[model samples]
Target: MKLHAADILVIFWLGFLTVSTVKGSVASQIAPRSSCVDLSTQQLDIRNLAKYEMQHIPVKAVMFITRRGIKICVQPDLKWVQNAIKFLDKRPVTRRPTTKPKSKPKPKPKGN
Candidate 1:
């Protein structure tokens, strides 16, 4: 079988293109999902303020754009709200009372 120089060049270019495309897709998949989240410095600052001041503040919802560029907002979990509330309502925990009265047990009856 005779392999033409042009055929080899074409095969090399095609392989290179295919490899690059696959690498690009795999790299994108491995990248952190939050890297695309549009959390601005101002927004993050505002969120921090609300988190500190309010027991349950609704901050920006997380969103993702699909390959077709459709935006989808993910609902925050109920536990996240609870956590926020707990955080805001947290008070300094005090130490428990150290001294407790010891209970005395009755002596067992003598065996017959």
Candidate 2:
């Protein structure tokens, strides 16, 4: 089999195109959906908040996830929001015990 410069270039171009197409699709799938249409200004209890995620589409806002599984969209520039984030960051993390406790064995009954 004879090798040519044009043939090598064609193979390289095809490989690049395949990689680019796959990368674009994967990126779209990995990006989170934009769910915030309205931003809330109401004050939220820091104790109820579990975590937060920053959203860019539709509007730039902070999505706060409460411990009760509620999602609240708030303006990122709000003073309370910023303070809440700082408080959450400094709060201690509580984790559930992973292992089960050992069970006590029952005493054997006396033989008749």
Candidate 3:
């Protein structure tokens, strides 16, 4: 059986997409998911933020990162909002370390 360039290209593209899709799904599954999200950054004060479903919206999700840098996403309901709040309040918001901002180099004195 003879395979043309198009056939090979199609197979390669399909395989690449399949692998990427699988990888994405696996990565998502590996990520932590729950009702209460623990955040690393103290920047967001979850205490005041409203995370539950709003008047019109049926679902609302909260995203935060752990001290260990694990990101978590959760939807609010009756059962877990309080628990999540407590968990966040207890842990000090350890902000993600920021890299030094690159300063613009002073205009090089007109090259001699």
Candidate 4:
């Protein structure tokens, strides 16, 4: 019973493909039923979200929009979570900037 390099590669690929195709994954089964979701901006409370999670209802992660308009998901209980909430609360929501449109003229257009 000897395994070679090619045997190891085949075994790895087989495991990867099997895991990818399986509908019920080990990770999904192990998700904590009582995770936190803190949406302070939307008046959504943490306790309410926890209740939903405990009932096996999927609670989406709390997200924030950065200056660049990139959406970032953060865990509620992180040390910096409170600070981030405060920061976002204090700032006004601005229009998300889009990718540069192809205009043949001004490199830095001053027109608003």
Candidate 5:
């Protein structure tokens, strides 16, 4: 393969951009650390098991931790799940509020 200075520069630039973008995406995905609600145990549970995924249950006092690879029920984090529910409840539901129409200004008369 013929090596060229321009080719190396282009590859380096592309790799830098890709890394930066991935970092930004991962940062955005992970919610900022806040005292709002604690879920330390839940997070550990998510990372430890190879085949497991957590799902928040709003109404019920339990969080589903189903196995991923084999797809089976593992265990429910009732207490932590409840805390998650509380956290979700505290979050504000953003919706555009309806408002009445405002009167428009009158048009000025044009000179003949």
Candidate 6:
């Protein structure tokens, strides 16, 4: 039996939809979830912190990322949290050193 052009087009469209749906679910699962459910009141050393991000979903807090790749959630209005933010902002930016090209020496003058 011969398949009509319309039938082939319909099959292609259904396959495309199924693939996109599966891809969307996988992507959502792989995405990082940053909502803060619990917050800590302990004071953290500003030196150990690498940076911070404000978390507004599920709770209002500050998420401090440590140099060791740990995330600490703290209340935004806390004195220590505010101080840590200021300290991080004032810290100098670190940059990688760039190599410079070597200059060639000029040719010696020929004997007269």
Whose TM-score is higher: candidate 1's or candidate 2's? 2
lDDT of 2 at 39: 96
Per-prediction TM-score:
0.32, 0.58, 0.29, 0.29, 0.29, 0.62
Candidate 3 per-residue C-alpha lDDT over 71-92 given as tens digits, one digit per residue, 9 for 90 to 100 = 4545444345557666666766
Best by TM-score: 6
Q: Look at candidate 1 and give me any clashing residue pairs.
A: none
- What is candidate 6's local distance difference test score? 0.92
The C-alpha stretches of model 3 lying farther than 4 A from their native spots are 33-112
Query: Which of the predicted structures, 3 or 5, would earn the higher lDDT when compared with the native?
Result: 3
lDDT against the true structure, per candidate, is: 0.49, 0.90, 0.56, 0.53, 0.49, 0.92
Ranking by lDDT: 6, 2, 3, 4, 1, 5
Q: Residue by residue across 1-112, what tens digits does model 1's lDDT show?
A: 9999999999999999999999999888854343223332222211242233211223445443433554433333445544544654573555778998888998999999
User: How many clashes in candidate 3?
Assistant: 1
Regions more than 4 Å wrong, model 2: 1-34, 100-112
Judged by TM-score relative to the true structure, which candidate is superior, 2 or 6?
A: 6
Error of 5 at 19 (Å): 1.0
- Residue lDDT tens for model 2, 1-112: 9979999999999999999999989888866564787999899999899988888888999999999889999999999999998998888888998998889899999999
Tell me how candidate 4 scores on lDDT: 0.53
For all candidates, the clash counts are 0, 0, 1, 0, 0, 0
Worst 10 residues of 3 by lDDT: 50-59
Quote the RMSD, in angstroms, for model 3: 11.3
Q: What is the C-alpha RMSD of each candidate to the true structure, in Å?
A: 15.0, 6.7, 11.3, 13.7, 14.0, 4.0
Model 5 residue 85 distance off true place after TM-score fit, in angstroms: 14
